[model samples]
Target: MRDPAMIETVAVIGLGTIGTGWVARFAAAGLAVRAFDPDAAQREALPEAIRQVLRDGGHGEAAEALRLSLHDTLEEAVSGADFIQENVPERQAIKADVLGRLDRAAPVDVIISTSTSGLMLGQFQEALSAPERTVVGHPFHPVYLMPLVEVVPGPRTAPEAADAAARFYERVGHVAVTLQKEAPGHLVNRLQAALWREAVACVEDGIASVEQVDKAVVNCLGPRWSVVGPHMAFHLGGGKGGLRHFVEQLGPGIQKRWNEFRTPDLAAMTDTLVRGVEEEAGGRDLNTLQRERDRKLSALLAHLAG
Candidate 1:
């Protein structure tokens, strides 16, 4: 684990959508941020976005006082950082090459984290010299709003490193959960894939429109998930029976349904078809849609807190 006292500077490599958000999150949590992006244009936008998000999230004065340093090269960015979060594109070969380079440049004490959604941390760390210090710190989109982060340790990772990583995320207001063992998709991806398969099947089978499918869960299940996860929700739902009672009564039905479930044929579904439905629901205006979703998520979070 990182020495709680020694942890201070944070470096974000490849300041794309997720990287920029990471900078905002760490900076908002009161850490000095060093950000790098090859595209100078995108790097230039970081300060303004960070400002707006902090202001919108009710930290206006702190946002104005936020200090963020932008660097041109990845090596320059991670030079003296205590932790380096890599957010490059998700191709294994590309990740291997970039991570190998970063490993050479960063200090031995710096912890390197990959933001790979489902890539195995052990596999990625193989390209690095001190693979034991590298870990997967995967965050969902809009990292600012979603506090849930999956901390996956490689096969060679030290418990101290994992412990330190978890503590850092929690210090920054994230609900960091360490996977007992690393696996593809970690936890959230598996849960999302299960729902995605069902949704795609429903759409392909003509059982519901895409809009209807999205709305069904977003309007109902989404709110619940924003607070408690599935297990706790079911525990409360079991009424007198609780979890054990639920398993005895509904477990068989679930197994039967699982056996009958079919995976969706992605090749059969065209982007045109998907976008056609999306357009019908005003999909062309992405900002409006994302804003609407964020508004709903914020409201739900506020209500849950109350």
Candidate 2:
């Protein structure tokens, strides 16, 4: 594995939301970025998009110092790259094809990382000539701002390669959680999907409106989770006895609630969910809402850092 300081050049493929964020982050960390996308418009707009993301994440000087180059082809982008961050479409076939090309073109030791949110790393590794160099580095949306990244190594991945990827992410100020085993949705996304299922069920059952459900999380669980995870929160809820006492006293009720939780029929509830979200948006455009969310995220991160 190369030293983190030696990883000065990175390739960012697919200049969509995640790819753009990766370009900004790598450039902000003082690595030269070679970014590529099939869409000419996206390629043209890449610099400004990255600039906005860096500025929004409170890295205005990094934005100013960002060293980036746009490329027309994957081979061109990764020719001299020390690491490759692939953000192609989520489909297995597409990812596999792109990763295969990267494996054939990139330096033999260059770690190829995927930003796949749900797909298992094994699905893409099969097509790579150097599968041992591939790993999953799944990150949350607005990757430039989010600190959490799930690092999952494929069955064929080298331990050193995974370690190098994690070290690189940490060097760029992200919290890289190395998973012990591969699973669908990795770790954080699985947790998020669980909460989302319940939130959607509440709306589907008419027990709460979309806005109400969001408010519940923002006002309570969100702030608490920002400080401590669920298990610790429950441990605190146990008072003198901690988790054991809480479980003994509240186990049955919790079990009953879990049993009662329904799997929402998404097809049937689509109209309701759409209408509810429209109401919640209250005519705010996506760009406006995204900017506001990023601003607040920056503030929260600053507070947490302090």
Candidate 3:
């Protein structure tokens, strides 16, 4: 049975990949989900996508009992929702427009969180009457399986609202990472972009092929990263003395020795990246790749759970 005190109804304001994932997870958690998307195909395809997500998570029984409703209009979707998740496109104008609409339509006290990967909530929250209740709840891809949700509050967002949103995500099986203040690309995305930029630089300068870089990560850093984050991993790298010794030993020379690349022109490298990724795919289509990824991800998650 569903928890009596848990929020009963969730409103998902888009039906794209992230939104569909959210809908699946919510339904699996026993919340009634109301969703709206302008695209007819996305709406039509959602039921099966949801089934796949639940199936990936071993929620096949929940898929049968899933209480998911599709609505034609945003207003109709947000109606009676105890919480709202906005996953519209990443444009500032579009997000502002959708958020403004949601602000007007959603119950005043309900929190509205965006699935924006990097946009700061302050940019669009100003147009809303309930800006205090608006926040950023950015999740990684495959939201049902990924544990982290970066919860960022706008300048106008109330502290209590941020706290409440974090608690809600935790309740639904997410690790809520709350930032003290929102930055240019939030937290994780910015870190990822930095590494991605460096990777492009590496390829541009002939330091490593795409395949080599990927192999290095997969065979070396990625496994360690799965277990320990940068600080802890580096601290362990310090032998017996830990972070203080590591910093003392390597801190001064770090920037001068390692900061050697400019962000390569993405346009110039587009073809290179595409060809490299294609070669890496080895003729496997997207569906096959996705299934393989999800399978491995499930095994890893189960091991982590134990």
Candidate 4:
């Protein structure tokens, strides 16, 4: 396999939000990007949209340094590309089909990564000719700013492929977390789902409003987690005795809390969530909200780095 650090050209399949973010990120990192999107309007708008996002994220120089080529066909996009980032729809069949085509069109050495939010690598690579070279490179939304990109490998995937992906992600200023085994929703999303289920349940139980819950998280848990993960935080909570003493003392209470946690009825909570979100949005357009989010994220990232 080629050295991932030497990868200079990338093919981004699907120019949706995630794909566009990948494009901007790679371009900002000084890689030539070949982008493909079936939707003509999306293809036309991507360059400017990406440029604006880059600027918003304080990567204005990357926007000027951006070397992007928009393509109409998949084959054209993958031609001579060293890496391929697939951001197609999350459906299993759709990913399988797209990945199969990518495997056929790209050279065997070119690493093909899927930006699936919560799908298994094996499901998509089952039919691929070169499954070993394919891995899941799931990045969080607003990929340009988010530092995390989960690197998951299928059962048949080569170890080198996953390692290379980790290296590549780190090269582009991301925290690459390589999983030892495959699981649905990978790691972060599963943790997020767990927390979200509780948050939804809190609202369902009339314990707190959506805004209240969000504020609580942002004010407390969010900053704490950012500084130190849950395990370490709890270790500190244990005081002088650390995790072992804390667990022994608090285990029963923790278990009780866990048992009380409910599986929320999402269908029932949909309207409630929509109304709450709309109220929180307060008539701000998506672009405005997104820009503000990116700006704040950038500032937070800088502070954390310091």
Candidate 5:
């Protein structure tokens, strides 16, 4: 549980998909949440969205525990917040603007963790006068349910800032993976992008359809990956020799596969990919699909916990 003294109140600076997820997670942890967004429609819909996310993720009771307030201005939302989660668009300019305002308004000691998946923190932390307090708290989708939060430090970030961010995330039911050194895309995203490039290549080469690609992961890679990462999986593949033996046997093949990887021109295949994905969706609207995804994910997480 979040210590009231440390992070009882949180400010969410944007109301996009990721921002809403942060609010959902923070609220579910019984934190006092104050959110601000320029979009009137988003502001109006936020409360219900948080509720729905909580209910869908199997933490419905936490909805009652949430003490949420919406503000028209950024400053109002951040006032007295012990921690801030910035969810602005991925663009450096937009992030710089919002974070600048936050840096000016938020308490100097408060942590300003962002939701950037790829951009390194040094690119935008310039706006923060207390740059040491700003850190990357990159999270995966359905942020309320996903346990992983990548915490990366910027060029000027104090080591303690990253530590504090990790502590805050842990308190809010997340596993904070701190990077030893800041990387451009961070760890998980870089790995995902590598696989994504190849997945796109498969479709571009006409070797697999979009649906088939998804099925390939679902049937093979997905299950094993859920239980153990690729390194450990390959280690087990060595049949008791571990990673060293596996690498010795498979390094050439792995290098060969990497040599063949290429990205498809996304624009050329956009229509086909979209159509194929729609077919895979099977007439289920986004809300239905998301609810089902979260439900299954919750079950999987519960089983993993056991």
Candidate 6:
């Protein structure tokens, strides 16, 4: 269980797509939320969206009383909050300003966390007075459902703060992995980028259609991933020999494949990706695509649960 000190009122800054969902997740876990978005109009829709998800997740009546105090200013948002989660634009300058503002405005004891997908935690930490309290709490999109939250501490970050944030996440039904070093994309995104690189190369080579590539993952690796991670999967695949033995035997083949694989510069492949999405889901409404993704993700979560 998480220490009570780390799991209290959570103030979420910037109510964009990811931020709104974060609000839902934290609020549903029964934490009082104080949220802010510079664009006042965006704050209007948050209540319904959060309530809808809570209803879907079967929170029902309690969802109605879920008090999300939408604030007009960042100062109001962080006032008296135990933890502050920044989900602002993905720019270092913007983050620096926000961190600076938060450091000056919020109480020094509050845990300051960011929802940056790939940005270095150190950059934002430098702007804060108490840099040691800043933590990188990166969560995937649709934060309510995805269980993974990478908890990274910057160069000057206090060990106690990182552990406290991890315990807080665990208390609210999240799995937190503390990264030992600050790196671009952290852990999962590195693995994701490696696969995405190959995926782009495959598309450029015309080896697999977009749908076919997605099908390959969904039908093959997806199910297995639900049971175990990539390393453990291959470990089991080696039978009695296990990973070390299998790697030794197949190291040459793996090297050969790596050399044979085409490498396309990712920036140059953005249009290719846009086209691939158009080809795979061209006419589908975004809601329909979301429904499909939600269905598969829900099933995967259930399988993992068992």
TM-score of each: 0.93, 0.96, 0.95, 0.96, 0.93, 0.94
lDDT string for model 4 (214-286, tens) is 8899899998998899999989999999998899999999999998877999998999998887788889988
RMSD values for the candidates in order, in angstroms, are 1.9, 1.3, 2.4, 1.3, 2.2, 1.9
Residue by residue across 222-269, what tens digits does model 3's lDDT show? 789889999999899888999889989997787665675577899999
| Deviating ranges (above 4 Å) for candidate 1 | 271-280
- lDDT per residue as tens, model 5, 99-208: 88988998788888888887788977665688988889999998987889999989888888888889888888899999987897899988988898888889888899
Give the Cα lDDT of each candidate.
0.83, 0.89, 0.87, 0.90, 0.87, 0.85
Q: Write the per-residue lDDT of candidate 6 for residues 1-306, one digit (tens) a residue.
A: 125455668899999988988898898898899999999888888888889988977677649889888899999999888888899999888888998999899776678889998789887676578898888999887798899999998997898889888888887878999999889998889989899888888877889877788889889987888779988987987879999877888878999999888778778878877888888897998899997887778677867788
Clashing pairs in 2: none
- Tell how far residue 243 is off in model 4, in angstroms: 1.1
The most accurate candidate by lDDT is 4
Task: For model 5, state the Cα shift of residue 232 in Å.
Answer: 0.9
Preferred candidate (lDDT higher): 3 or 6: 3
| Model 4: CA > 4 A from native | none
**Candidate 5 segments whose C-alpha is farther than 4 A from its true place:** 1-5
Ranked candidates (TM-score, high to low): 4, 2, 3, 6, 5, 1
lDDT (C-alpha) at residue 50 in model 6: 88
Clashes of each: 2, 0, 0, 0, 0, 0
- Against the correct fold, how does model 5 do in TM-score? 0.93
Error of 2 at 20 (Å): 0.4
